[model samples]
Target: MTRRCGFAAVIGAPNAGKSTLTNRLVGAKVSIVTQKVQTTRFPVRGVALADEAQIVLVDTPGIFQPRRRLDRAMVRSAWGGAEDADAVVHLVDAPAQLGDSPADRRAQADVETIIAGLKASGKAAILALNKVDAVKREALLGVSAALYETGAYDEAFMISASTGSGVDDLKAKLAERMPEGEWLYPEDQTADLPARLLAAEITREKLYLRVHEELPYSAAVETTAFQERKDGGVRIEQTIYVERESQRPIILGKGGQTLKWIGQKSREDLSVILDRPVHLFLHVTVDERWADKRAFYGDLGLDYDA
Candidate 1:
């Protein structure tokens, strides 16, 4: 049998489970997953090797209304992922589309934005109605209808990214769609993200999970130091930058409690992922304009100004 390989850019709105789907298809976490909106700030490519097929999944940032330089850049990167891919999977959160809440309506609007982009580019996508585990069958049918009516998708799949339901079928379909060619990446390589970026993302995940409102959005973490211990363990040092001194105390908590919690959670995740004990050091600092500067975004392989 000939080898099959190509890129499949998984694009969608925030909280759409695109990251979760990518992680599942790749069998490991590459892009960070969070409850907060706009969690993914750039594209993270995760490679999914299935039998003779190698699907290089470009997990792009959630597309949303761009209110700042960072947002514009992120949104640009998201569409860029789709424009350059051999296949595109627009993963929609089906539950959100079914619910009668303002958040749900917002999710619908984002999906429409993607459909519009596909139409403008004359691109046909593989629509994946994700999070079906949380939604009723009838609701999923509604989502499927809306997407199908748009005529923006060539195929569709209903999947539960977190539960692995219908995922194997989706993977088979995605693999079948690959064009015959040599693999773009080694079969053993799971993700294209650098360790530093992944480390920073893990911390950011904890931040979004534990913090609230403006703090998580106003802050970013970068790995400043990574060293190997003689005992075959790893030590990581990261600096968390916030936009204000007042927010620093919020992140640090009354007795430096919040920071410690963040450190513990991040270290736990690192240990599990690396399959070795990890020592994580986290320090909080205020860098009010980190989000507005080009150099900072460049470090994460993102242009600050779109």
Candidate 2:
């Protein structure tokens, strides 16, 4: 039997559980997830090997309004991820559609945007009503019906990215969409992202957990140094750069409390992910124009011009 392989982009609005879904589908945590919106800023590729099929899952950033250079790049990557996809899964947060909530509105807008993008590319997509674990079956039907009206999605899968409910079914459908070909990656590989980028993503996850408002978006993390020990462990040094000096104290908190907390959390997460003893050194820096600096995004393995 011939093996199958292709790209499947998981595009969705902010906090729509795209990262969580991607991780579940790949059977590993390739992207970070938090309660805050816009936690994912780059296109994270997670390779899923299911029954001799290779599904490269593209976990993109939340599609929303662009207000800054970084935001523009992130939004660009989100849609751009769908360009060459063999399958596009539009994961919509069902609960947000109850009223005139921003997530509800964002959900509508992003669906239209995805439709436009797909139309221009002459491609069809699949709609996945995510977070079904938190809502009712009837409510999910409403979201599915509304999105199906777009005439852009060929299929709809209601799944919960967190509770592992209905996720395997969606993953199987996505895997079946792969073109007839050999596997594109090694069987053991789960992601195309480099370790440094994964390290930065882990730090970004901690930052999003510790910071509030738009601070998480204005800040970027970079892995400055990484060393592997003789005992097969790793030592990593990271820097979290905020766009303004005033934001520094907030991240640092009283007596360096917040920064310490963030560091501990990041280290704990990294240890689990790397499966090794990680000596993580975290520092907070103030960069008045880091967002405007294209090189900064490039360092994170992201497309600055996207």
Top TM-score hit: 1
| Clashes per candidate, residues 3 or more apart or on different chains | 0, 0
Model 1 residue 112 distance off true place after TM-score fit, in angstroms: 1.2
> Model 2 clash pairs?
none
**lDDT, candidate 1, 171-261, per-residue tens:** 8888998999999887678888788788899999998888866565788998999898999899999999988888888888879988899
Candidate 2 CA-lDDT value? 0.83
Cα lDDT of all candidates, in order? 0.87, 0.83
TM per candidate: 0.94, 0.93
Off by over 4 Å in 2: 213-216, 301-303
Q: Please give the range of 10 consecutive residues that has the lowest summed lDDT in model 1.
A: 208-217
